[model samples]
Structure formats: C-alpha cells, structure tokens
Target: MKGLRIIVTVKQVPDTADVKIDPKTNSLMREGIPSILNPEDKNAVEAALCLKQQHGGTIIAITMGPPQAEEVLGEVLAMGADQGVLLTDRAFAGSDTLITAFTLSRAIMKLGKYDLILCGRQAIDGDTAQVGPQLAGFLELPQVTYAEHISIEKGNAVVRRGLEDSTEWVRVKLPTLVTVTAAVNAPRYPMLYNVEAACDGSRIIIWGAQELKVPETMLGLNASPTGVKKIFEPERKKKGQIITGDPKDMTGILIDKLQELNML
Candidate 1:
C-alpha cells in the first residue's frame, strides 16, 4: 500500500439531534449548537487510517464548508491523516446536495491520483445520502455505499453493506469510492503528541473554482443544477400520555381510546 493515496471527504454539521428551528427565517439556528464530525464520516476516516496502517499509504481529508470547517479537518489530521484541503468560497453557500457533490468531486479530481475515496454514509444535518453516490457518478467510478466492513486483498476489495432488509457483500476493484456507516468501526481519539503535531503541522490547502481549473458552469452557483427554493421547519407533535395498569384493564382502555379516536 506504499503507493496508495486516499482521500476522505468530511463535513461539519450542527448537532441536529438538539437543533431548533428559527421561526423568523424558517431556518435552523446552528450557532449555539456544538459542531461535530458526522458520525458516519468518522467511520470513513477510521477506515482510511486502518488502511494506512496495513498498507502504508497516505490519507488526505477534504472538506467543503465555511472557513471554520478547517477545525474539523484539523481534527482528522490529529487522528493521523497526512493532509487536508479546505474548499471554501462565498459562492459555495446555499448549495444543495447535488452542487455539494460536484464541488467535492472537482476538488478530488484536482488532487490527481488516488486508490480509494471514502466518505460518511450521510451528514447528520442534511441526512441526504446522495452525495457519495453522486460523486461516484461524477467520477465515473464504482462505489459501495453503507459499507459496514471492508477488506482489501491484493488489488481487489470486499465490502459488507447494510441495506434496508438485510446485509449483502460486494466485491469491488481498486481505485473505488466507499461510503462507510458508523457500524464500520469505532474511530480513535487523538493522543497528546499527535494533537501537538497536528496543531503545528496541519495547514489547510484552500482551493477556488479557478484554482481547480473547473468549468465556471461546473462549479459554484453557475454550475449547480439544483437550488433550495425555501427552507422551513416542520410542525412538531406532542407526545401522548402513557397509562400503566393491569394488562387486561390497560388493553381494554387502550382499545376504547383508539376506537374513540378512530385509530383502531
């Protein structure tokens, strides 16, 4: 694996589990919420790190977000990635999932050769799992999504994937892209020494549309084929009270309530 070059795409998203809707703008106010690496993406980095350990390759983490997203890239470096690239531009704002995938794929193409590309199953904030597969489409490369386990032997790779009904195994060729789920592996925490090194050595290589030499219509607002017309919060429902009693009595009461509500 000495010559293998890997790229991992990461994103910084608001901790949506605790997110709140801002009524005024009909948008999510993410300021106060703590930002975190998308859980599934951490699995992506861990998978790359594991590959590096066994094959002695280099890992580069790429992220597309605001300048502050560099923090997430630095964290990946601290975990032992070789380098990071930050793709930031005001024009990149308001990009939908399709635009986001195009931007990321362009950045990866700019970096040249890579044996493997890894990404998280989905971002917690958007929960749109399209980017990984979209990127594979853009790159014209094969992809394995929702991968729970991966093993590389010789030049071929075997991956176990999680699906709606059951798990299935897939065998893919080298130089492929894989999107991993949190079930893949537990990511490691950075040690004190690596923390210091990452702080000192990590430098994000920033790229713009021009720098990447991508077609103007292929990047930013001009290139994006999709748009978010509006963003709003969905209505929240209140939880119903639970009644605990003798099984026979509770069942009778529940049936009565359901019949009265026409839900039976």
Candidate 2:
C-alpha cells in the first residue's frame, strides 16, 4: 500500500479554566496567560498518528497563530508528527472563522498533495465548530465531522461519527477531510527524546503571508465579515431564603416553600 499523506490542523488557545477577558478591548487577555494546544486537536493528531502507524504514512501538523503558536507545532512534532507548519502573519490577526478557514485552505493547497486532512471538531476558545466544515467547502473535498473512529480500507475512509444520541457511519473517498471528536482516541504524551528534538526546531516550517502569496486585502481583519460588538461578564445573581426550624419543622417549611413556588 502506498503511504498516505495526512495533514492535521491544530490550534493554541488560552486555557479555558483560567481565561480572562480584556475589559478595554473586549477581547481575550492573552498577554500573560498560559496557552495550550486545543484539547480536541490533540485527538486529531492522535488519529493521524494512528493512521500513519497502520498505513505507513507521513503526518504533518499545521496551525495558524502568532509567533508563540509554534509551541503547539513543536508539541505535535513531539507526539510523532513528521513535520510542522506554522502559518503566521500580521495580516492574519483578528481573523474570524471564515477568514481562518480561507487562510488554512490556501496553506493546505500549497502543500501540493494530500490523502487526508484531520482537524478537531472545534476549538475551545471559539467552539463555533465551523472551521473544519468550512475548510472542506473551500477545498471542495468530502468531509465527515464529529468522527469518533476512522479507518482506511482500499483508499477509502470508513468513519463513525459520534452524535448527541446515536452514531452514524460513512465511507469517504481518499483525500477527504475529517473533523475528529475527542472521543476518537487518547493522545500520547511526547517521549522525552522526541521532546528535545521538537524543541530544537528542525522539523518545523514557518510561512507568512508573503510565502502564501494571498492577496493582502483578503488576509486578515479586512476580509473577516464578522466583528465582536462587545464582551462583558454576565452579571452574577444570588438568591437565598431563611428557614429557621428544627429538622422536622424544616422539612415542613421546605415542602411549604416548594408548594408556594408551584412545586408538588
């Protein structure tokens, strides 16, 4: 069997548990906060690595972010990706999902040929779950989303999708795009030896707008159709009622309160 050429899209996002908002700009305060590879994206990389192991193929991890985003590429490299491609440019800042999909489509095209493209179902930050499907539209390739299991047989990809209530199976031709859910597989920790090589930066490739040759007008915020109007924390509301009574009396009081509130 010929080796498959696979590409996995990954992202660096602010840790959701510690995320902060910029009061002034109404954006994420990412300056000093910690960032990590989008969790689901790790599953995507793991899926690619598994396929590569079974079919004897190459795995290339790709991401778009600021310079610091390269850290994610290195992480994927340590996880067994053969190469890492980082798409970064000043013009790509403030891009929405549409523009992001377009930019990634351009980068994927530049990679020449590929048998499959893998992506996380959604990024934790945006959770829009639109980029992977939108990128499939841009590339005009068949796509399967929320894939929990994937296997290649005779050049076709057999995928089982994890839905809210049930599962769906589909077989797509070669050169398809798949957005994998975290349920697909567990990601592996980087080996200590590979971690060192990944950090050394030998297998990573960096591309800017100049190298991608995309029209400057279509590169960033200018091309984005959506903009954040405002961002504010939801007001916290508190409610409490006092019931002073012994245990038995408290039970009666609770029942009365529930009944008063229209409960049985």
Candidate 3:
C-alpha cells in the first residue's frame, strides 16, 4: 500500500444555489457569494480516505481554481488527505468542462504515478457531468462513473455503477478512474488536531500552463470547443393554486383540473 497513490479531484465553486445574477454584466456576481467544496466532491475525498485507511496509501486531493482555492485544499488535508495541488493561472479562467478536464488530466500526468483517480459525479455549478469521463478519455484509461460503492480485491477494483433502472457491477484493474456519487457515504469532518496540522503544513502546489506544459490551444477558453451561448435567469413560475377540499373532493377537483388542462 506504501506504493499505492490515490488522487481525488476536487473544486471550489460559488454557492450558486443562492446567488443572484448581475443584470449589468449578464454574469453572476460572485462577490459576497460563499464558496464551498462541491458537495459531491466531499464524497470523493471520503472514498479516497477510506481506501487509504484499509490499504496503506497516500491520498492526494487536486483542485483547479483561483489561488484562493488553497483554502479548499487545506480543508481536504484536514479531512485526512496527505496533501493537495491547486492548479491556478489566469489562463485557466473561463474554462468550460472540457478544458477543465484536460487541465486536470495534464496536471495529474505531471504528478507521476498513481494507482487510482477519484472524482465526484458532477460539480454543482456546471453539472456537466463530463469531466470525469473526459479525463479518463484523455488519459485513455477505463473509467467507472456514477459509482455507488467500491471495493478492492487483490489489485483489482470492483465498483457498482448507477444505471437508468439498476446498478451494474464492474471490475477493473488498478490505475482506473472512478467518479462517485453522494450515496457513497457521509463525509467526515477533520478533527481539531488534524485541522491544526493541515493549517500549518498545507502548501498547495500551484501549477500554471507553463508549469503543466499543456498546450495553450488545449487549455482554458481557447481550449474549450464549446462555450455558453447565453445564461439567463429562469422566469419565476406563477404560484400554484391550492386545491383545498376534502380528500375525495380534492381528488375530483384534481381530475377536473387535469381534464381542463388537457393533461388527463
């Protein structure tokens, strides 16, 4: 297990769930919006930690965001990760999911050998759900996505992948990439002692396009083959009418309303 290395890809994003768009710039006004670790990503960290606990190994959490995102790295370290890497550069800004995956894959490649890569199912802000698979594609490694659970037997990994109606069990050799979902397990907060250690020793490795040596044509906005055409606030839907009546009467009224709406 000493030679085994597990890398967890994490991100810091604005809590867009409660954020408001700026009418002036037609962009989200991230100012004052709290940033957090993508919730599903916490599950990824937990997965890596669990694996390290069972089989002695090093768990490295990697994130691509602004320099300030080192805070997120400290949090991950506090939670038991050995250390973290922060991929930051002005060129990395405005990256869509494709470029993001490419940047991470390149950084991981520079990080040397690893037995496995773990990532969350999706980032909350983008929700493209493409990065994990895309990184696997770029790495040309077999991937298991939407994993609900994982186990190791000898040097092989057995995973349960969520499907449309059921789950599929897949076994893959080491060095495979896997994306986990929230159903994996509850993430553990770092204890006070570990938190202090992390706060003192966490030095986020900041990688730029030059350091990573990834082609600029394959990074950031230019590297992104797609871009957001438009982003508009959703119109507020009208309040629903309350069907206040006895149970039988409510059922009848619902049926009448459905028929009136031609949805019956």
Candidate 4:
C-alpha cells in the first residue's frame, strides 16, 4: 500500500517560558534564550503519525529557520517521520509569518505530491496562529484550523474543531491542510533505534532559497508591507486588594469600584 504522503511543518522557537520582550522596541528579546522544538508542532507530528498508523503513509517533517533548526527536524524523524527537510538560507532570515508561509509553500511545492499538510495551531513565540492558514492560502488548498481530533474516513479527513465556547465537526477533502492543537494527541518520544538515523546528516535534505526556485523580490521582508514585528505587554505595577465579605457585598463593592473608575 502506497501510504499517504504527509508534509508536517515544524518550527524551532525560543522557549517562551524564558522569552522576554524588549521594552524599547516591544519585540521578543531572543538573545541568549534557548531554542526548543515548538510544543504544538509536536502535536502536529503526532497527528501525522496516528494517521500514518491507521493508513500506511510517509511522514515528511519540514522546518525553516537558521541551520540550527535542523536539530528539531532530527527530533521529528526520531519520533517516526520518514524524512526531514530543512529550509535554510540568508534570504529567509527575519521573515514574518506571511513571508514564512510563502517560503514554505515553495518548499512544499518542490516536494511534489502530498496528501495532507499538518501544522501546529500556532508557534508559542509569535502566538499569532496565522502561518498554517496562510500557507494553505498560498497552496490554494482547503484547510481546517484549531483541529483537536483527526481521523480519515472514506478518503476524507474528519476533524474535530475546538472552539472557544463549543465543539464543531467537519469533513474536509484530501490534499488539505489542518492546524492542530495540543489536544490532538500526546506526542510519542523518539525510539532509541531511530535516534542514530535521525542524527545522521545524510537523513536531512537541506534546501536553500535557490532550491525552492523563489525570487529575491518575493522571499522575505519585501514580501510583506508591515515591517514591524513585535509583541508587547505592558507591566502592571498595581497591587490587588482583598475583600472579605458576603457574596452580595462583594458584588456591590465590585460594581461601586467599576462605577468610580467610569468602567461600568
């Protein structure tokens, strides 16, 4: 059985726990921070692995970042992916989500035929949750976002969408894209036997901007109009006050405070 060909996109992100924002520019202060495989992308890979197990297929993990990003690809392969592709080049440096999606589309196009593309709902560092949908747009493929559960049925992908208030179920056509959340499945650790192959340089296929056949004009910063890339949250120095009272009294006090502040 020629298994499904899955293209799973992964990322190496600054561990958000230790990541901080530059107060001056209001962007991530990434210097000296450690990089780790994005948490959610692991769920994306797990989804692919489950599908492959259910219906024999090939899992190809892909990522675009500095060459150090290959480390994450190796981890993906160890977790059961058949192959890995690293997109690295000076041209792709400092790319925002939009440009990142375009570059990934180029790589995926180069990969030839694929049955499905899976991605984490969002990268923790950015938290914008835009790339998967954007890549789907570039590829002109149908997509389902915030997927919590996925299963193949009758040549279609049955997806469970986790929304803020309620759940939704939808069946999408094959050759589609789905951005999964951590709820999809717990990622399996890499097997010891696969560790060696995963670490070997020969297993990773490196591709540069030239390999993707993309032009300089369309590669990075110029591809996006919004030049600013920043995420900022102002520090709050105010202290909280505790109120010991009956429920009704507390509600009344809250209402009074809101009214005093012109916030009600």
State residue 52's C-alpha deviation in candidate 2, in Å. Answer: 0.6
Q: Write the per-residue lDDT of candidate 4 for residues 1-264, one digit (tens) a residue.
A: 367999999999997665777877767888887888899999999999999999998999999999999989988999999999999998887788999999999999999999899999999888889999999999999999999999988778899999999999999988899999999999999788898988977778999989988887788766765566556675767998887799999999999998999999
- Model 3 Cα displacement at 36 (Å)? 1.2
lDDT of 2 by residue, 7-107 (tens): 99999998765556788888877777689999999999999999999999899999999999999998899889999999999999989999999999999
Q: Each prediction's TM-score against the native?
A: 0.86, 0.87, 0.88, 0.89
| Count of clashes in candidate 4 | 1
Instruction: Indicate the residue-level lDDT of 110 in model 2.
Output: 95
- lDDT tens readout by residue for model 1, 1-264: 555698999999886675776776656789878898788888899999998888888999999888889888888988889898998887787667788888888889989989999999998877889999999988989999999999888877789999989999999998899999999999998556766766674356988767777665665666667655566655678888698999999999999999999998
Each candidate: RMSD to true structure?
2.9, 3.8, 2.4, 2.7
TM-score of 4: 0.89
Worst 10 residues of 1 by lDDT: 214-223
lDDT, candidate 3, 1-264, per-residue tens:
465599999999897776677776666778988898888899999999998888878988999988889888888998989978989998998788888888999999999999999999998877788999999998988999999899877788899988889989999999899999999889998767777777775356778999998777777877778856667778999999999978999999999999999998
Q: CA lDDT of each candidate? A: 0.85, 0.92, 0.87, 0.91
lDDT minimum window of 10 residues, candidate 3: 197-206
State the local distance difference test value for candidate 4. Answer: 0.91
Which runs of model 2 end up more than 4 angstroms from their true locations?
Answer: 234-264
lDDT of 1 at 68: 88
Candidate 1 regions with alpha-carbon error over 4 angstroms = 1-3, 23-26, 201-203, 236-264
